[model samples]
Target: MSSRIIAAAVAVAAGLALAVGGAATLVSLARPDRGIDLQNAPAGNGVDGGVVDYGTK
Candidate 1:
């Protein structure tokens, strides 16, 4: 009986830890813009910018 109780407690703790970690990961990924805001980003011109530039000018 005592061994069963200890096993149950350990299982519950492990499940709670997994749930919290998963929630944290999802929350960190909640923002779409965040995925783009990396420290070292690429510097490239827009693909359709030439069309807009000539048209507007």
Candidate 2:
């Protein structure tokens, strides 16, 4: 096949790959899997103890 035809095919394949990946990511993130419950989360986990301390006592 010609160089132009090959390049076009490669570009189309790359675009499809990107579209599929992005759609999958979006679908996974959109799923209502009853994620972390802030209202019922453990208290005093040192979340606000200090800056960037994050769950550390």
Candidate 3:
């Protein structure tokens, strides 16, 4: 019983840590100024920019 409780606590802690890390990563990625570029512009779109660079102009 004690071992099970300990395991459950550890699992919960790990899950919370992973969730926080994932949220932070997504927030960082969604930022425009310093986020990663994930755009998929067409070949002849004539608009060369990142995914979050729409409002900077």
Clashes of 2: 0
RMSD of 1: 12.0
Position 9, candidate 1: lDDT: 99
Tell me the TM-score of model 1.
0.44
lDDT of 3 by residue, 20-49 (tens): 999999999877853234364344455655
**TM-scores of the models, in the order given:** 0.44, 0.45, 0.47
What's the TM for model 2? 0.45
lDDT of each: 0.79, 0.79, 0.77
Error of 3 at 49 (Å): 34
Model 1 spans > 4 angstroms off:
31-57
lDDT of 3: 0.77
The ten-residue window of minimal lDDT in model 1 covers 48-57
lDDT, candidate 2, 1-57, per-residue tens = 699999999999999999999999999998865654555645575564534446766
**Candidate 1 on 4-52: residue-level lDDT in tens?**
9999999999999999999999999786685568754554587334332
Could you say which candidate leads in lDDT?
Answer: 2
